[model samples]
Target: MDTGTLALLIPIMALSIPLFRIWTKHQKEIAEMEVAKTAERAAQYAASNKELEDRVAVLERIVTDRGYDIATQIEALRDTREVEGLTARSESGIN
Candidate 1:
């Protein structure tokens, strides 16, 4: 309203604008950090999943090479009544 009040208010308003900008910038930095962390965690999960897939492929190959049938193996594992060991044995005492 008056010259003195206007002079005081103008400097205060100018200082508040810089403080608001600084607060917003800090918030933006924090949000960016959170996004980066989430991306890193997602990458780690993807790597672990890929490793598990590779290990599964290796196991499948080993099983096939040992003359073990995949379908038969899955059926035998699904059978709750059977008490078969990890290694399958034929009726003639051969693996």
Candidate 2:
């Protein structure tokens, strides 16, 4: 209402505008950094999930695919090792 009061209020309000702008800018920058960090974490999780999916796919194939006939091969290999062990023991005169 008075000229003296208006003069005092004007400078205070002007100074507050710049301080408000600085505070808002600082908050915006911090929010952007948080968003970026969250996005990075999400990307890492996605990559880890993809790798696990790939490993699961390989395990599924090993379990379900019957074309390899792995059981017979393993048995044959075991028989071969037994024969070799016998031969080695006889050569060494160890019974």
The TM-score leader among the candidates is 2
What stretches of model 2 exceed 4 Å from their correct place?
A: 67-95
Candidate 2 residue-wise lDDT, 3-57, digit = tens: 9999999999999999999999999999999999999999999999999999999
Best by lDDT: 2
Clashing pairs in 1: none
TM-score of decoy 1: 0.57
Report lDDT (CA) for all predictions: 0.86, 0.96
Would you estimate the TM-scores of all the predictions? 0.57, 0.67
Q: Taking the tens digit of each residue's C-alpha lDDT, what string does model 1 give over 1-95?
A: 99999999999999999999999999999999999999999999999999999999999888879775777878877784354532345554765
Poorly placed runs, candidate 1 (over 4 Å) = 1-9, 69-95
Listed per candidate, the RMSD to the true structure in angstroms reads 8.1, 3.8
